[model samples]
Target: MNTVRSFGFLAKKILLLSLITCWGISGHAQEQRPNILFVISDDQSFPHASAYGSEFVDTPAFDRVAGEGILFMNGFVASPGCSPSRAAILTGRYPWQNEAAGTHASSFSEKYTVLPDLLEEAGYTVGYTGKGWGPGDWEAGGRERNPAGPAFQDEELTPPHDYIRDTDYAGNFRVFLEQRPQESPFYFWLGTSEPHRAYEEGIGRAAGKKLEDVEVPDYLPDTPEVRGDLLDYAVEIEWFDRHLGEALALLKERGELENTMIIVTSDNGMPFPRAKANLYEDGIHVPLAIRWGEHVAGGRVVEDLVSLIDIMPTVLEAAGVEHRGEYVMTGKSLMNILTSSEEGIVDPSRLAVYSGRERHSSSRWNHLGYPQRSLRTHQYLYIRNFAPQRWPAGSPRRIEDGQLTPMHSGYHDIDAAPALEVMTEQADDPYFNRYLHLAVGRRPAEELYNIKKDPACINNLALDPEYEELTQSFRERLRGVLNKTGDPRVAGDGDVWESYPRLRGPMREFPAPEWVLPVKED
Candidate 1:
């Protein structure tokens, strides 16, 4: 009888010890997950950082990350616009797949689970500073906090220029570090609302920026005003880089730099005419650099086609977190490429990446949006504009208080900038008229550009007889991807895109299209 009792006690002791051992192993594994530092700038383009050998802008922090880890040459965002681009990054899906969240200033549906929430569920403390997943109403979408994470924008500082945001991004990050539990891994988003628009006129000139340093794109005129505007943009980029450097310094001070995966990129291209809201190269192509200490092999440059959608999967994989939700992510993880030592086209199967837009601003009649889908490959960029009759850059006229306003009073799709102002005000001038047309011109149903020959996307090869076959093949490829992705535009529900309400920004008025006119009584 005593031997029987002794055996039962031994069994219980072994079970309890096994449970305690499992708990310790689980806790240690959670702690071993690397921290994530995601830094995104407001409106920046690829090849702007000094690391890319740009003469105008100096970004030592971005350069540092590139030098220490890997620099991606062909990094593209899912969309050219801010809200949709950010939404894509958070959800690991295309803009159109995100429903209202896919469009600008629309609701982020509660159905779409984001990265920050996933990280938090995996025992990671996640927070964000500065802009995070917005210019839209996340609260209206039933989210209690910003999609990026909880906010850490309590700290402020005097900005060098009025257009620059006063949010002290680095300082806010410091506060976040202080408040974070010592044992937990963290995910922090450092978003900078810089180089967007509304720069102090001639601030760059006042700061002793030389016009000679500016490299003007073929789309815009190479005049003093444009150069100065670009310089001011460079100044803002520097400010963003400065804050990034400070954040890096803090991590180093805490001895956390070695264990953190650092990602630096932009939401979209520069906020210039034919750039920000357009589906051109400058719009969707963005700079990307990632540093993961010893995990990612250092001092390499990759030229593979990559999208911001990949960021979500990369983060989840790095943290060993399973993506659990109703929807599956469309983007594949970059872990294979990051961990590989080979540079320049690490993934040969990554043939092309896709980008599209619905509405940028309330720029059309009845608040209609310009719907476009594009497929970009190594040498070519093919675009399919669904609504060819509508103005590509919003209508030129607007109705005010039930009265028609002056001609050229609109074009709200283009962000108001000194460069745009010059183009419009000097539209009558022979030299500037061409630029004005380029900025607010009507686009064909299909457009193609040889990206290698014309990165500015000035030459359209879609209509060229020599490229007709190529264009058709690209169109079919785009269709296949769109259909596979369940894009509404290709699924006969394309009109539903325009029906999504613009939840934020001013709703402008324009003359209704003929199709919408009431039939006359005979």
Candidate 2:
């Protein structure tokens, strides 16, 4: 009996060895451990995918992922904006823990631990294509190489594309997969630049997307133009989904699909006004799906209060590693929930999911930003904008392709798009100007919304005397989370802008405020 058992164990080891060589890597630590294939999408909102019930576009690949694994309807980002959210994911710590990484332009510090660095130390071959954790300082974070993996050799690998075409993700992923070692288990992050701004107009229409099929959210006016724009965004999302499909197919062909853990999610919400930069549902809420064949139950929906920060811990746990104390990380591993028949490990409505934004770019000289802290529960949404004086859309700096026009087609805030046009015209009337307060005008210290009833958020219940009690409750809740999480907004009096640094990007000087004289003027 002992000899038979030994033979069976040896046979399994030999089979594993054969599979390892095929993926260009070697054997893993254990049979139960699976390689992580994380896919991150940029600027995608939950409402854009069919799995989350988006009327705008059809996401077959994303749906396929959800159908084959677990779909998280309540997935959210740690920050309303990109840089901070990503920092939280990679560091396994809140934005607050990441020093300057808390806000945009606040660089990530090297003293902190990082995901790729940690995984690489554990003997995983970590290679990333598309977007790696970014929009901040990875080099300063002690990530000397682009891959930032422990196994990274600067001469052998290059940083993934900073400027990426929607379809380029698959090609980069292919290269990463082809270059990996068969014996070494891998962790590959497929960051896709999709559904972000600067997309070709009419792309969705070209994809056979009907204008009528798109559901215009209440924030934007329902019009052919807006619908068309949304469809265009959908086209890019579908493009991203195709990349996922291609990667999955390759994994299957290599016989590593079953042993690979897949996580598909987006960085933040759609890049639209009152959404992207703001701490609204459209800004923070996102779609997420996880699949680990024979491990995570298929066709399950977990409506839990999970944030992007949780992803790092979950990945560590999935890799058969334990994250012990002494490291103050707030993220929780969802491994048990994924593998179990449990409906939802954590209640979606149990706690308030918090998000805030700091300096995004060097719109101003002093790194002034529309800092805000928000909490979203099952019913209500609360926001505390620290810099009510600063423009939430941005500091009115002309961006070339972003907020600037003509040469770049400045798209948001003051754009002539149908939605903005309609809303702008509405401001002409006294009623709408007040309503437009929700859109652009200066907000109070606290803004509250009952999302269940007013999804468009045209009304601010904070000022309404009748809803004062509800508003106050949300305010207290927001403060409590801020206090517990050590968010600067609570004690900083929500003045996060005072501490954040300005962006030093190429467009820094171009968008310099008119009030400031150029060097030539001196």
Candidate 3:
């Protein structure tokens, strides 16, 4: 009997040991998950970072991230406007897939689950600093906080430029770190409001930036005013980089830098005419650099076409969390590309990326949007403008306080800039008129550009007989994807985009077009 008792006791001890060992393994696995530090800039473009050899802008922090990890040569946003672009990033879905959130200043629907909330549920202490998920009202969508995360913008600083926001982005990040539990991992978003608009004019010159060093895009005239404006833009980008550097320093100081996956990018392209609100190359294409210490191989440049929507799935995969949302995510994960040791074109299947825009600003009669959907490959960019007759930019006239505003005073879609002012004020000059028309001109129903040769989108190849077959093929591909993804524009509900209310921004009045009856004001 004593011998039998001993055997039972030994068995029980062995079982306890096995349970303890399993617990240790589970704990270690949890600790191995990396932290996420996503940094996004406002209104900055690709190839502007010094890592890409841009002459005018100096971005040591972005360059450092690219040098230490990987630089993506082809990174595009789902939309050109801030609200929809950011919404597409937060949710792993196309801009149109997210109702209300698909357009500028509209409500972000609570139905679509976002990255931060998902991470927070998976034990990550999520929060954001600076700009997060808006120009739109998240509350109206029944969300209690910004879709990016809970706010950490209590800290403030004295900025050098008047246009730059006083929010102390790095300082707030420090506060978030202190508030997080010691054992829990974190996912923090560091958004910069710089380079958006209202830059202190000529601040770049004051900071010793020469106009000669600035390379004007082909679409814009090479003039002193335009060069100076671009330089000022560079100054703001540098400001954003400076804060990013500080954030990195904080992580290093805390010995958390290596365990953190740092992602540096922008919401959309630079806020320039023919760039920001348009569906052209410069409008949607933005810089992207990812560094995860030893996890991601350094000094690699990838040329795969990637969308900002992929960021959501990538973050979820890195965290080992499964998406449990009801809505389907349209973006594919970039884990394979990110982890692979290969350089260019890591994923051969990633051939194209899709982007679209709707109701960027109250630009047309009855506040109608210049709805456009596009398909971009390495060699070509195909765009289908739904309302080709309507002005791509805002109308030439507006009514304010029951009085008619002057012509050229309307194009509010193009953010106020010295370059735009120069083109408009000198519209009579043959040199400036061409650029002015390009900035706010009406587009065709079908537009295609050979992106490789005409990156500026100066030449439209859709009308050329030689490219007709190629254009048709691109159109079919774009339509196929839109239909598969259930895009409202292609799903017989294209008009639904116009029905959504503009939750924010001024509602300007424009005279009704000749084709439509006058809209009565409520």
lDDT per model, in order?
A: 0.89, 0.68, 0.89
Task: Name the runs in model 3 displaced over 4 angstroms.
Answer: 1-29, 517-522
lDDT of residue 507 for candidate 1 = 91
Model 1 weakest 10-residue run by lDDT: 1-10
Candidate 2: regions farther than 4 A off? 1-31, 146-167, 324-327, 344-350, 396-437, 493-499, 503-522
List model 1 lDDT by residue over 404-517, tens digit each.
887667898888888888888888898998988888888999999999999999989998999999999999999999999999999999988887788889999899866678
Estimate, for each residue in 35-92, the C-alpha lDDT of model 2 and write its tens digit. 8888888888886788887876677878888888988888888776667788788777
By lDDT, the better pick of 2 and 3 is 3
lDDT of 3 by residue, 1-522 (tens): 132343244345434543443221245446587899999999998889899999999999999999989999999999999999999999989998998999999899899999987776566677889999988999899997899887887789999998999999999899888766666678999999988998999999999999999989999988999999999999999999999999999999999999999999999889999999888999999999999989899999999999999998898777777787588688999889889999999999998999999999998889999899999999999999999988898898888887878778889899999999999999889999999999898888999998899999989999899999999999999999999988999889999999888989988898878679767789
Error (Å) of candidate 3 at residue 396 is 1.0
User: In candidate 1, residue 76 scores what lDDT?
Assistant: 97
Clashing pairs in 3: none
TM-score of candidate 2 against the unseen true structure: 0.81
Candidate 3, lDDT over the whole model: 0.89
TM-score of each: 0.94, 0.81, 0.94
Instruction: Give the Cα RMSD of candidate 3.
Output: 8.5
Clashes counted in candidate 3 amount to 0
lDDT of residue 399 for candidate 3: 81
Q: After superposition on all CA atoms, what RMSD does each candidate show versus the true structure?
A: 7.8, 8.3, 8.5
